[model samples]
Target: MTHTTHTTRTTGHVAAPRPDVYRALLDPAAIPRWRVPAGMSCRVHTFEPHEGGAFRVSLTYDDPASTSGKSTARTDTYHGRFTRLVPDGEVVEEMEFETEDPAFQGLMTITTTLTDAPGGGTDVSVLHTGLPEAVAPADNETGMRMALDNLARLLEHPG
Candidate 1:
């Protein structure tokens, strides 16, 4: 068997300031609202908003027919820690999936950078490294895009 490490990078613009965007990134209460992809939900079981702080979260597919769950039949669970946090500039996390499949066992590093856009809003860039071979690059990009979209909506129109 061959070992491979995949990487994915995605960027977007949110109609919000860097501080507000940064707050949304670390706030546990805001996680479930913005960190989830479409057709799924996020449940943050454990969260600590600081460097070296650990967090555990589960994403459950809304449709029972979805078979893409890495941890269980319909849920993808992972636990990791905040390796680095740079105020309103960046957030870095190291995480891995809870799965019995050998193809999905590995540590993934996610680095999210926030900056001011040229025109307006905040420029968000997310880089994912060390993705497992079982996860398609297209799927990962799609999920990240969806999550970014969700974050934008939450920050731009907070009711």
Candidate 2:
């Protein structure tokens, strides 16, 4: 199996938001609020949020083609667990994504680091490893940025 690695960084000013990275990533109820692109929704079918705990997220898009005219549908399913969690700073999750599209099938491990910035903001960095060499790194970079941007927006509007 060919291996590839990609890294992405996203920084935003979050005013007095929670400083805990585990809280931001592991909370099932808060996942749909920020774990995907804007307009897409995430549902955590099972989440334990600790080392060796089970984690699964069903991502549903709002497009007709994605949902096949259904009101809600799953576009992608992620099954994995938190390999490591460092309280409010770092989390390492090993995940495998299953999709209807064959091109997207792969095992990936994402190491997320959240650092307290100068102005009470969080500098979020994600290092993704074990991607298939056939997959373009740019695609991973763009997707990570979009997800982080969505997360920033969600933190801004908690309702």
* Best-matching candidate per TM-score: 1
**TM-score versus the correct structure, for each prediction:** 0.97, 0.78
Whole-model lDDT, model 2: 0.69
Q: lDDT of each prediction vs. the true structure? A: 0.96, 0.69
Q: For residue 125, what is the lDDT in candidate 1?
A: 99
Model 1: colliding residue pairs: none
Best by lDDT: 1
lDDT of 2 by residue, 5-119 (tens): 4444444444434464447677887787767765566778999988899888877776746652112353667788889988888889988776544455567888888777676
What C-alpha lDDT, on a 0 to 100 scale, does residue 48 get in candidate 1? 98
Among all windows of 10 consecutive residues in model 1, the one with the lowest summed lDDT is: 1-10
